[model samples]
Target: MSNITVCSHPIIQQKISSLRSTSNTARDVRELVDSITRLMLHTVTADLELTPTAQEQTSPVAAYTGLEISTKLALIPILRSGLAMLNAASDLLHTAEIRHLGLFREETTLQPVEYYNKLPRTCSVDQCLVLDPMIATGGTAEAAIQILQHWGVKRIKFVAICVSRRGIDVLAAKYPDVEFFVGVIDEVLDRRGFVSPGIGDCGDRLNNTA
Candidate 1:
């Protein structure tokens, strides 16, 4: 029962709409993605735990206590395209531990292969955010979630720019507790395993390969 959330924010809608057209250059795509990622993260991080602490001496007007996030956050951005979302996610959670996981799909089988992993030494956290721009086949997201589950993360959230019905089905069946937030559900997948009406291959667009 993966908790799925589709962003209805107008700002997100407008930003991502610019991404649908392939005419945009790599820099344009990256900017649009960063803006959309920040918008999506607002919803994903809403439930983060907080703790209040007393301040000894702070404001010039008066002294007061303040509340700060209590949860330890980890940002696991699947390699290549996920890297595009890192800057936005970092701005949202400045204190979070960032890890890089490199996974590429086997072109013939549509399976994910882990080529690199650099998780934090502790390998544990109160919350984890998995970032990937496209959710076409869902193999990569599932693999990353499994890794976080084994590391003892109590809460996990998956964020993407846009989703497909097929992709949502894969996670909803297996991850009832994980939260899924995407800018939109495109409702189709191409034969080559790409989300239809998507931003195209985000990695290729950002890295200028395509």
Candidate 2:
């Protein structure tokens, strides 16, 4: 599980607790999700490569070397629910290309069904970050990762608010080279495949669809 990073920041924990409440309005849920994603961005991007550039500039009093991220990046947010986390990621990686991958879980099968994909014919980014609010059964996540890999993304990472133990295990076993950054991991999935004690139906909560 070395590739998995579970954030334990108190503020993130507090926000996750609030987000799980049934009492929050759609507005409240959206705000909490945004805040949590923003807080987690630092840890997710901590290892990005930086390179010195000749574009150095002088500050008010002193000259300083300019450094910039060298890796070409892309943000692939699974549609609908994943859109909730897009803003925070885009704010941090302002130049990253944005792509949408739409997938939904089949109620009876608990399997992922892909409905939309916006990737180009050939991969152009060095690293890709998959943004989704929850990893429930791992089916959807697995499908998403496979699509990205098929598209030729070499370095991939998944960022989410919550994940299930089962989901993490499934992904780790299949994609050992991939990385996961999540706020918390619940112990199990409910009978219907939702994460136990997880942020309930994130898309519904974010959009008041439920």
User: TM-score for model 2?
Assistant: 0.97
- Give the per-residue lDDT digits (tens) of candidate 1, residues 52-123: 775665788987778788889889899999999999999879999898889988889999998998775565
Clashing pairs in 2: none
User: Could you give candidate 2's per-residue lDDT for residues 52-160 as a string of tens digits?
Assistant: 9878878999999988888899999998999999999999999899999999999999989999987899999999999999998899999999999899999999998
lDDT of 1 at 114: 87
Predictions in order: lDDT: 0.87, 0.93
| TM-score of model 1 vs. true structure | 0.94
TM-score for each candidate, following the candidate numbering: 0.94, 0.97
Best by lDDT: 2
Off by over 4 Å in 1: 120-122
Best by TM-score: 2
